[model samples]
Target: MSRTLVSALVYVLANGVGLLVASLVLGDSFTFTFKGFFVATLLLSVVEAVAGPAITKAAEDNVPALKGGIALIITFVGLLVTNFLVGGMHIAGISTWLIATLLVWIGALIAQIVLPRIPVKKAVQKARGKQPGKEG
Candidate 1:
């Protein structure tokens, strides 16, 4: 899969699962709704599509945390755009939006960490720019 497609799927799935589990555990009315969770997932996918590559590219080069932090801010801007696109941006003066964004970011990071360990076949690796004895 292209990096963008894989990133979007992983972001949405992980965010959805995280929200579902958190809702069950917290029993909070706000986070317990399907709409809330799905909206957050959608927002996360948008962020991943836009800023994920930059962050991963930065990570590949071991960029300083300061740069990584800036990448994260860009990620949030992407997330807000997604949210506004799907469901208007009304902050409601509540912390749930912030909390949801943080949760999704954590989930996305986990997905990023786990994806590289999935072990592609040699042929597939080569096609994706990996070589048998050399890392690309």
Candidate 2:
């Protein structure tokens, strides 16, 4: 597939996993129906794709000191926007909101680091198999 498609898939999967972690960790305070999980993931992905760059740019320009934490803020904003825009996913309690944001942000960061490795490993294995003196 194209690079853009692969990137998009990665983002969706990462967000889905992140949201799953949040729901599981925050239990009563964060709830999602099966369908709501997928809906929320897609909504979050869209929101991040559309708004993330702009937000990051504004932050970079206005407060360079926030560069490191801008991603966390963006992720939190995505959750808030998704919560307001989508149905079935419910978030309650101030503490839960904060925890959910941190959980999703950390989950996505983990996914970003780990998910791409699988394909890369496969490609490396295939390349090794094609080496000149290699036997099948």
Candidate 3:
């Protein structure tokens, strides 16, 4: 696969994991159907992809203080966009929204760190296998 495709997949997976974590943590406050999860994941991934860089740029130019929070801002925006538009997913109350945002952000952050390394580990193991008398 191309780098872009791999990156896109990683991003989608991260968003999915994030959403799942948020839903699991928030319980009834953040609810989604079985199908709604996938829809929300895909939609959030698209929203983040489009908004991430734009928001980063805008923050850099307009609000320098927000530079460190670009990812969080993107996550919050993703939830907002995915909230009403995605049919099966529902987010209730201000507190739920705030907690969901933080949980999702943390989940995605962990995913981003961990997901890319899986392929890298497989590749390393495969490479080590090619050499004779090498121990992994």
Candidate 4:
């Protein structure tokens, strides 16, 4: 896949994983219908993709000390945008919102960093196993 396409896919997948985790772990606190989940995930990905860089750059240019928290800020804004600007997700309260943001950030990290490597790792192992002198 092209880098841009892979990046987009990864972003959406990451958002979905994060929302899924939040819904599962937080239970009623973070609720969404199936359709809502789908819409919200897509909207969230778009929002983050657009706003994330701008937010990071703004913070870097203005509040450089806040640089480290930019990802969290982006996650929080994405969640807020997903909740209000659209009609899919229903974050119950403040706690749920914060936790959801954290979950999404962590989920995105896991998805981007760990998820893609899994298939590659498996493929490498399979290829090695088929080699002439390979063990295990």
CA lDDT of every candidate: 0.57, 0.89, 0.91, 0.85
Estimate the Cα RMSD of every predicted model relative to the unseen true structure.
9.0, 3.6, 2.9, 2.9
Off by over 4 Å in 1: 1-8, 18-40, 51-66, 88-94, 115-136
Span of 10 residues, lowest total lDDT, candidate 3:
127-136
- 1 or 2, which is superior by TM-score? 2
Encode model 3's per-residue lDDT on 1-136: one tens digit a residue.
9999998899899889999999999999999999999999999989888888999999999999999888889989989999879999999999999899999999988998999998787787777775433664
Q: Given candidate 3, what's the lDDT at residue 52?
A: 84
Q: TM-score for every candidate vs. truth?
A: 0.46, 0.88, 0.89, 0.87
Kindly list the per-residue Cα lDDT of model 4 for residues 1-136, writing each as its tens digit. 7878877887798889988988888999998888999898899888888998999999999999999999999989988988986665688988888888898888878888877777677778787776433666
Best by lDDT: 3
Output the worst ten-in-a-row residue range by lDDT, candidate 2.
Answer: 127-136
lDDT ranking of the models: 3, 2, 4, 1
lDDT tens per residue, model 2, 1-136: 9988988999899998899889889888999888888899999999988989998999999999999998888998999999997788899988988999999999988997788888887788787776443555
Candidate 3 structure, TM-score to reference: 0.89
Of the candidates numbered 2 and 4, which has the greater lDDT value? 2
